[model samples]
Target: MPLVFSDQDLQTHNTLGLPARAAVATLDDESAIPDLCEALSSGRETDAPLFVLGGGSNLVVAARPRRRVLRVALRGIRLWRETTTHWFVEAAAGEPWHGFVDHCLSQGWPGLENLALIPGTVGAAPVQNIGAYGLELDQRLHSVVAWDLRAGRERELRADECGFAYRDSLFKRDGAGRWLIVRVRFALPKAWAPRLDYPDLRDYPGLGSPTGGAGEIPSPRSIFDAVCDIRRRKLPDPAVQGNAGSFFKNPVIDAGQADRLRHRYPDLKAYPQADGRVKLAAGWLIEQAGWKGRRLGPVGMHERQALVLVNHGGAQSADVLALARAVRADVQARFGVDLEQEPVVLD
Candidate 1:
């Protein structure tokens, strides 16, 4: 059996560093999935709450688990090519996301560079359709292979079927639990040009971007390094401070509301989305609320990145959560816009 049930294991097993423990199991192999599923399902008769953990990066431990926390550990990568213009890549669900990103850059891919250094595993990406800088994981994901719990069979879902939206997907919708992602595939370009549509990219004089209609395209390495630099300067690395990257999704309101806020604030930043809703920066809103670098007890906003809520070494999960709730309430009270948290608070 690949399962381990311990009496007292170090709870530092999570990214948030919250004191949490679960009857744990690190998946041994892909074939072992069925047995594990059977075990997990049968145990639900006790009707205890069960949590499927991925990277444990974006979650906050609420109630201490009386049940098992199954750590999915599947790993590997496969590359494919249809023509000189078409290439593809497939990675196992349990692979580290940033490592996979490094692999892509090493192999000369473009779409994932802007998302470098993002914490978490591959399986978690589709849950929120992880995005950063100006690119989303959905842009590179060609399809996903999953194990359907209900039918007890595996299924392959194309990118279109993912129902991707701003920080959301079908996996997060009513279709959830029907499938557990086993492998994710990507369709990349062989003679690919880098895309530099984001402002940071535009500012770089010699950056290469196939996405841009004009500019002398540099190598993928150059683009990757530049993106890393920009991200390091902007976001807080969770290793230093406990945070799930951004604390909230950028509020997407109607154009009229955006214009209204813009005129009133005069300097409020809003980016136009394809769906006709304007995407306002949550960080900008928080900063406008004067919460930037503000500290209330151990729970406070990140000094460099206003979007992350960090624990100053000894703050409890509840402390972080209360702070988030307060910030959300403040933003809602001030702007008539409700701020939704990006991190999943298990409480």
Candidate 2:
């Protein structure tokens, strides 16, 4: 574990382009976890809370303390194949998520193409069950390897044990700070089955191309490419405008409630959730409430995406927060639906 202390904001993450004055630590050696835990857990002398960050893509860190906040930079990939159908691949948590997806597609594996262009690391993917375009990570996941800081030991957990849900898992539910991910593994098939029902990517003509070899699918590449295109057009480039793609997880409501809202609005759109509940697009509701592209001080909704709140340069965290609160209140008042932000807000 080679740790570095810096007073400067490391980088403007996808989060509203705010820089966190945080220290960045990297764990390159898998065997060094025990020692790393002992050092990070020695919180006896400081009031600063310890945090584990990866890719800095999912956070909004406005202030950083002097203590260690480790960012997993572990990078590697390995495959274990007992048979063509019984194989899984493992990767270090810090590996660029899309890079891994592309690698798998090159090898003809399936299950992650729909999740392409998602910003962040593989380790963080399972925590929130990162999903898009009609796909969730759990559909192909096998297990996860994380270091339990309190126990001073490493544990490999089955996918079910990780507690998968819509935009949530055990880690996200409990505000997980103690578990440090080291590596992740997934079980996928070479065959192709297109999940193109989502509107953004359904038009891809060759979406269900069959695999030539075991677990090798022709459709994954097409799907991945198409998703990237959709994301580029819909999501503002973080490098330019700086924002998380979608700020809120769509609110799930009962069909009756959904029908009532739709009947009232006459144009409000919703989709069926996996459970019996139906989901209302928060963006659509926000736009209908006339919050889209509305500005207050330096923060406002992006003109292109009703869900994304942008820091229009030199905006403070307080400004952005106020806008979010206003948007939430407006949406709730108009549609009786609540909005939840996707970024992790640091105090």
Candidate 3:
């Protein structure tokens, strides 16, 4: 059986360092899930509502949670299989995402290099289709092993079966409380080509590519190093500053609307997507609205990255939320774009 604790202090569990408590259970083995589920179904255990908790990097918890929190602690990683053209890797849900990426790179697995330094656990990766640089999780995901909370059964879902779109997945939509992902598999191509089309890599001279001239291809390790360096410079360290990285999602608007915004704000940064929609940089919008480095009591926008909402010290979830609403309202008023929050608020 998984270990159970009553009235657990969750301040350390969440990245934002929010004050919270709940009836907590930690799962360290997959075989134990059946027994736990049986207990829950039989009403042998408390029948409180269940909440799945991972690394808590992208969460804002209320001061008090009356639910039963299930913290996934199972851990392992392996090269599941390899073919002439691709490698299949598997990781346990509780494995730290960045650590798994680093492990793959050390083993010469190249596909995940562009997603370095991202916080959170592997189990939570598919929830938001976590992405960075020029790569997204759906691009590499092979399948997901999840336990259906509602059906009380374990099932496997292929990449296509997972409805993935713009920082969203089945785990986030209708399947939210119905599934608990226990493991994830990734397919990485052996025939790899470095993706340097992103403006960050293309504009930065030290990151290579721009100065490499024609026909120069950077190694996977170099790409990984550059991505790590860039993220470290752009985002605040969660250890020193309490924050949910990138508090808002970049708004996707129609090309016509984007053109109008561009005509009004000549320096506006917009990227044309393959689907004809334009992705406007949320950080740029917030910064232009003058929210960067701005503070509201203890809650404030990060000085370096406006998209990140930080808790300076002893800030409550309400305070952080108030600041987020203010910033969103300002962006909507100025640019007519509704900035959706990225963090999952658990009250």
Candidate 4:
């Protein structure tokens, strides 16, 4: 069985630095999953609700949670297999996401360069279908190995079996306590090309011309460095000021609604999707609503990037949710668009 602790303090576990406590169990070895599952199934343990935790980068924990927290600390990485067109890499669930990306690049695997510097663990990546700079994890994922709590067995799911959408997946939608990801496999393409389609990346100085002209194409490391720099400049360091990255996901609206908003507010920043919908920038909306840098108690949206909600000092779950509600209400009343919070809330 894995090591279990009673009423573990979660302040350091989450990036937001919120104070929380719960019955915590650490699953450091894959071999212990069966025993862990059996323990839960027997109901001899506490009947409290169970929650799976990763890096805690994208989470909001309520103070004094009446739940059992399962911290997935399983760790390993390997070049799983290779094909003519792709290099398959497998990483344990507990590995830091950015470190995994950097490791792959160091080994000459370049497909995940665009997603560099993202917070969280490999196991949590597919849950949110994490994306950045014109690339989403689903695009590169090959398969996932997870322990199905319902079946009481380990299972490997193909990419297709995992319903992936914009910032959502099967694990996120239905897995919850039903599935515990053990490992993630990525199929990085060998024939790599830089994904500079995102405006910030394309317009970054010293990264060659926007037209892909005579200038030398940037390497995977160069793109990775640029992305890291951009994020650092825009988003606050969670260590310095507590935050959960972007507080809201970019809202997708119908084409008609987007057109109306754009017509009324000429400066609206909206991107057309392949589908008939349009994705409006949540930061711009929050800033326009006059909530940028505004605070309710100790929590507020970061001035540098309006999308990031920061915990200036001692902030509780109530404070975070109150600010989120206020922001969402203001944005909705102003533009008739609903802003959805990105991070998962654990009560």
**TM-scores of the models, in the order given:** 0.90, 0.90, 0.95, 0.97
Candidate 1 residues lying further than 4 Å off, grouped into runs, are: 2-11, 40-47, 174-178, 209-215
Task: lDDT for model 3, please.
Answer: 0.88
lDDT of 3 by residue, 25-142 (tens): 7888888778766766777766666778899998989898766788988899999999999999999999999999999989999899888889999999999899988889999999
lDDT of 4 at 110: 90
| Candidate achieving higher lDDT, 3 or 4 | 4
User: Clash pairs of candidate 3?
Assistant: none
Residues forming the 10-long window of minimal summed lDDT in candidate 3: 206-215
lDDT of 4 by residue, 283-343 (tens): 9999999999899999999989999999999999999999999999999999999999989
lDDT of 2 by residue, 139-228 (tens): 888998887777778898998999898888877776646788888989886555777778776665544455434333446677888888
Sort every candidate by lDDT, greatest first: 4, 3, 2, 1
Better of 1 and 4 by TM-score: 4
Count backbone clashes in candidate 3: 0
Q: Backbone collision count in every prediction? A: 3, 3, 0, 0
Best of the two (3, 4) by TM-score? 4
Question: CA RMSD for every model?
Answer: 3.1, 3.4, 2.1, 2.0
lDDT of 2: 0.76
User: Which candidate number has the best lDDT?
Assistant: 4
Q: List ranges where model 3 is wrong by over 4 Å.
A: 2-5, 43-46, 206-215
Itemize residue pairs with steric clashes in candidate 1: 194-209, 194-210, 208-218
